[model samples]
Each structure stands twice: as C-alpha cells, then as structure tokens.
Target: MGISRHATAHWEGDLKTGKGRLSTPDSGLMQDTRYAFSSRFGDEKGTNPEELIAAAHAGCFTMALSAKLAEAGHPPARLDTRADVDLSMEDGPALSRIRLKLDAEVPGIDEARFQEIANDAKENCPVSKALSAVPITLEAKLKR
Candidate 1:
C-alpha cells in the first residue's frame, strides 16, 4: 500500500503585492503567506522555493540517516539534522546548494564508520536523489 499527502496554496492580487495561504489538506493547518517580486527580486515576505526545499531536505536526510545508523547496527541515540537550500533567481527556483549539518550520538561507533554512514545518507537520501541536479554539502558530528 502507498500513502499520499497534499497541500494547497491560494493566491490573490498581483505578483509584486499578492498574498496567499498554504494548507495541508490532510492536517488542516493553514498558514498565511505573501509573495512579491520584491521578496523574490527585491527582498520582502511569505514563502519561497528555497524554504520548501529546505523542509524536504531536512525531513528526508533525517530519515535516511536513521536508516543508515540502524543498518550499521549502531542505531543512533540521537540524531539532529538541518538542511539549508539556496535558490538563485538567475536560473529559476533550482537548488544551487544544500548545507546539511547533522549531529548524531551513536554508541560503539568509530569515526570512520560514522562518517561513511553520514556521507552515504547525505548522498542517497530520497530528496537528494530527487534533486540530483544540485550540489549537497554535508557537515556531521558524531559522538558516542
């Protein structure tokens, strides 16, 4: 069986001064948002593509890292991951770079083994696979 999720965004007015709201149809959480050419072009409110990408990256990397740790027989005591996605307007809303920082506490794991798993998770995470056109950089700290 497969599961599906959905989100919807509603926009009104012009691009430079338009506003909208985004909601998770399944969860019923609606967030007020606004987008402008100034924000996209001039720097202004609302949400942008980079923010969405970051959300996806953060969730995907965490799951991937957890799987890696479990597969390696270490099983993380704690894992914290963050991803920062960069978007350059010159080339549309494409991922330019992803900054992934991970902090993991895994018992009985050596540095080499930890690094290998972290690197593999960074490179092979579902979001990473989907955004193969972009470059991803990883910074991981592992502790016993």
Candidate 2:
C-alpha cells in the first residue's frame, strides 16, 4: 500500500470570526496550532494553509533534489529550497502558482548540470507531482 499521512483541523464558529486549530499527531510538529481568517487573509500572527503548503513543498523538493544529486553521483554539501504558494481569488480562492527557489552547494558539479538536475527534481518531486494542477516555476542556483 502507498504511504498515507493525516492532519486534522478543528474549527469553531463562522468563517470570518472563526478560529481553528491544526494538529499533526504523528509528527507532533504542529500541535493545536492556531489559524484564522485574519491569520490567513490579514496581518494576524498564525499559521495558514498556504504557508503550510509552501513548507511541505519546500521540504519535499529539497529532499528530492538531494536524492537526484546523489543518484547522479554528485551528492550535495547543502541544499536550501523555498517554496512560495500564491493564493488568489480569480473565479474563487484558488492556488494560482508555486515558485521554488533552490540554492545548492555541490562539489565538482557544473552550473548546467546543476540546473538540469534541479529542473528534473522540480518536475519529478512527489510534491510537484501532487500539485500538478498548479503552475510551478523554479529558480535554481548552484553555489561553490
């Protein structure tokens, strides 16, 4: 069977004034973390769905890149990835695009080869595959 993970959201009251708590029991990384309309759409301090998605995408992409590099015999010394999830209300509130910015330090790998690997990871990563409906862009930099 394929791997499965789960998180739960507990919301109270109406949308505008309601508050919610998100919890990931398995990892315990998020325990009753607060999220609300203000935190999502306004300047309130809390977690939001887009931010969570970005975090997941960034983490997945980074690990995928590492794997790709290792498979290519150019294991990375370090890799940093940032995913930006854009949420817009065109027809409705939808995830319009995702941008992945990756900075990698690999010994003996050229820029062209690094770019190729980064592109491959961006296209083949699990998270990228899962979010295939959204437009995904990548900016990769190889550092010496």
Candidate 3:
C-alpha cells in the first residue's frame, strides 16, 4: 500500500481576482493560507504554487541527499538545499525547470564522492522521480 497525503484548496470568484485558501488537515502547516492570481503572477504578498513546489522540492532533495550520504557511510553534518522552480509562458504556463543548489558538510567524504551522491539523490528522490519530465539541474558543493 502507498501512503496518502491530503491538502484542500477552496477558490471563489473568477480567475483574475479570485481568492483561495489552501489547508492541510494532517500537518496543520497550512491553515487557510491565501492565494490568488496576483499572488501567482504578480508581486502580491501571498503564497504561490511555484513557491510551494520549490519548498517541497528543496525539502525532499535534502532528505534524499542525507539518506544517500548515510548509506555511503559518509553521513552529513549539515545539508542546506535551495530549490528554484521556474515557471514560464513560452508555449503556455508551464514549469520550465528546477534548479537545486546544495551546500553539504560531510565528515571524511571527498568532494567527488559527495557530488556523486548528490547527483544520485537528484535523480532518484521521490519528488525528482515524480518531476522527471521537467529539466532538473543540481549544483552541489562539499563544504569543508
């Protein structure tokens, strides 16, 4: 069986000015968070889907990297990841690419090995697998 997670979004009115609330009952991390067209396509002070996607990607990649390092017997002391999701309107509104930047500090691991593990995580992480259709790039640095 597979685990399931749920989040709900409620939207009212037309697309341009319509407002919506997004919530996750299980974690309560999001409780009626607001989003709208402006929030998505403009400089509005609210959350957007792309931002959320970036957060999820960053988090998933970080965990995956840690797991990979641990399995390689070079567990990381710290792993900082930042994911950037690019949405473009070339053909239409689409996610063009995702860039993952990782700064990792792992004891007794060479830079080459750390890079190999980071690459593996970027390719095999659950989120990365799910988003395989999108172009994903990784920049991993081993911090001493």
Candidate 4:
C-alpha cells in the first residue's frame, strides 16, 4: 500500500488573505488554492483537497467493488462509480459527508445480491477505511 503525491505552495501573507497553487506530481496545471472562507468558494475553477479525496475514493471504491464482484463469481462487465464529498467548517479541515453512486452491468446477480456486494465493497474499500470519520452514503444501480 504505497502511494505518493506532492504539492508545493507559496504564501506571502496570512491565511485569510493569501493565495497559492496546488499541483500534483508532474501535473502542469497550476490550480488555485485559497481559504474557503475567502472569495474562492465554488467560484474558482481549481479543485481543493476534498475534491481530490472524492476522486480517490471513487476510484478505490470502484476497484473494491469490481474485486468483490469477481470474487463472488459474478464479475461485472462494466462498473461506473462517482463520489461527491461535502466540506464544512464544523471542527476543522474535515469531510462533512460523502455520497457514492455506482452503476454496474453484471451477469448472474439479482439486485439484492448486487446491493450486498456493493455494501461489502463500501465497507472494505481502502478510502472508506481512511475516511472513517465521515459518513458515506451509497446508491447502487444494476443495469438490466
């Protein structure tokens, strides 16, 4: 379980009135980074850490679900997962909640069984384990 990402930031002033750029490893895009309470809440085009976390969670959950399906002998023909992370200022820089949606096309599984597998995937996914402080909701659909 080894993964790495790097970002460099430069700030000239205090947190409320400062701005920075966040970039991934080898990414060419200079994303705008600032305090959420500033004038950059949902207006700036750049992404924040919560969005990145959501992306990772989505990918991780999809892979976990795929593995679960295959392990159950009903491998999915296709699986699409999307995760939405909401950020709030209750305590600190923490994820308020996460919503996950999964659409899959697999053979030889009923909706109930598919849902069971999806629940298992959600509980066992790595990202989910890492984000145990946040509540996650799942909506799974089986394509007929």
Candidate 5:
C-alpha cells in the first residue's frame, strides 16, 4: 500500500493589459554593499521574472562571497554584484545565459586568492545551485 500526494494548479487569463515593458538596466558591474549601493529589488515596479531571478542571484552571490572572505581572514569592506539574466526569444522565450559582474573590496587579499574565493562562491552559492539543472517532483489533484 502507498499514499498519494496531491496538489492543484490555478491560473486566470485576461488579467491585465499585458503591457509589461521590460527594463534592461544598463549594467556596469559589481562586488558588495548593503544600505550602500542600494539594490532595489523591492516593489518590483512591474518587473518580469528574469529581473527577479537576477536580483536574487546577485544577493545570494554577494552574501556567499562575504562569508567566504570572512572565513579566509579577509572580510570585505563592501561587495557590489550584478547578475544579468538574458531572456532569449529566438527559441520561444527562454533563459539563455546569466552574467555576474562583481566588484569587491577586501582587505589584505590578493587578486588570485580573491578570484578563487569569488569563483568558489559562484559555484557554491545556494541560488547558483538552484539555477543549475536539477530534478523535480510533482503531485496533482482534481477539484470536484
């Protein structure tokens, strides 16, 4: 004998004007900050999912980098990170690539070690892992 998990999907069309104008912020770069550069992910301002993903990725990477730096005895003064998620329409609107631009200020850290730590954070960050390919489980139930 086995138990079954259940879930439901819901959606309503014709909800809005569908006038979601995309905002491609002319990205400069990144590496650390807080109440400093002011990453405005709040309110969304009617942004798309791609933008949200980018914001989350950026924040996650920054935090990860901070932890890495501190662990390595070189706590960062600040970190500014920008993650650019590219949405491609060439093949039915898909996420093609993600670019992370980071500008970091760490005391008593060399370029080589900093790069290593940054790469480590990029590879090990929670968000980065989530963005990677993974298996999914699902359950569905019907409404009567």
Candidate 6:
C-alpha cells in the first residue's frame, strides 16, 4: 500500500477576504493554523499554501539527497536546502516557478557526481513529481 498523509482546511467566506485554518491532525504540527488573503498576498506573517509547498519540497528534496548520497557511499555531513515558490498574480495567483538551493557537505564526492545525484534526487522526489506542472530549478553547491 502507498503511504498517505492528510491535512484539513477550514475556510469561512469568499476568497479575497476569507479566513482560513489549516490542520494536520496526524502530526499535530499544524492545529488550526491561521491563513488568510492578507497573509498570502500581503505581509500578515502567517502561513500560506505556497509557503507550505516550499517547506514540503525543501524537506523532501533534502531527505532524498541524503538517501541518495548514502547509497553512493558518500553520506552527507550536512544538507541545507531552500525552496521558493513564486506566485504570479497576473494569472490569478498561479504558481509560476520554483527554485531550490542546496548547500551540502559530503565527505568524498566530486562535483560532477554530486551534480548528477542532486539532479536525480530533485527529479525523483515525491513533492517534485507532484509539482511537476510548475517549472523547478535547482542550484546545488558542495561546501568545502
């Protein structure tokens, strides 16, 4: 059977000025977390879908990279990844692009091999596959 995760969204009102709460019951990390139009479009400092997606992507990609590196006999000492989701309001708040920046410290890996493995991890990551419709770019650096 395939693994499954679920989250709940509760909204009350129209899109422009509606209030929203997101909850991840299983993990309890997000219990009735606030999300709103101002938070998404403006500077309300709450959580948004794009931000969530970015977090998920970053986490998934980093983990995948770790696994891949270990399989290749080069387990990483540290892997820092940042994911950015760009929202284009010109087309009604569509996700335009995504950028992933990864900084890694591996014991013994060459640049070419690291690049190949990083690209493979980015391509095969579950979150990346789910968000395949959006263009994704990656910048990976091997920290010395």
Off by over 4 Å in 3: none
True-structure lDDT of candidate 3: 0.93
Per-residue CA lDDT of candidate 2, range 12-79, in tens?
99999999999999999999999999999999999999999999999998999999999999999999
**Local distance difference test scores for all models:** 0.80, 0.94, 0.93, 0.82, 0.63, 0.96
Which 10 successive residues of model 5 have the least lDDT summed?
Answer: 135-144
Where is model 2 poorest over a 10-residue stretch in terms of lDDT? Answer: 101-110
Give the poorly placed runs of model 1, Cα more than 4 Å off.
28-45, 91-93
Summarize candidate 3's per-residue lDDT along 1-144 as a digit string, tens digits.
999998899999999989999988899889999999999999988898999989999999999999989999998899999999999999889999999998888999998888888999999999999899999999998888
Top-down lDDT ranking: 6, 2, 3, 4, 1, 5
Candidate 6 wrong stretches, greater than 4 Å = none
User: Backbone clashes in each candidate structure, one number apiece?
Assistant: 3, 0, 0, 0, 10, 0
Off by over 4 Å in 2: none
Return the TM-score for candidate 2, rounded to 2 decimals: 0.97
What's the residue-level lDDT of 102 in candidate 3? Answer: 89
Better of 3 and 6 by lDDT: 6
Output the better candidate (1/3) by lDDT.
3
Tens digits of per-residue lDDT for model 5, 45-112: 44446666788888988899899989999888878887888767686767777888887767788777
- Residue 115 of model 2: what lDDT? 94
TM-score of 4: 0.80
Q: Which of the two, 1 or 4, has more TM-score?
A: 1
lDDT of 4: 0.82
- Model 5: which residue pairs collide? 30-80, 30-102, 30-103, 31-79, 31-80, 31-81, 31-103, 32-79, 32-80, 33-79
For all predictions, the C-alpha RMSD in Å is: 2.3, 0.8, 0.7, 3.0, 15.7, 0.8
Compose the digit string of candidate 1's lDDT tens values, residues 1-144.
887777777878887677666666566544555544555555666566577778789889989889888998988899888888877667565557889998888999999999999999988998899988888999999865
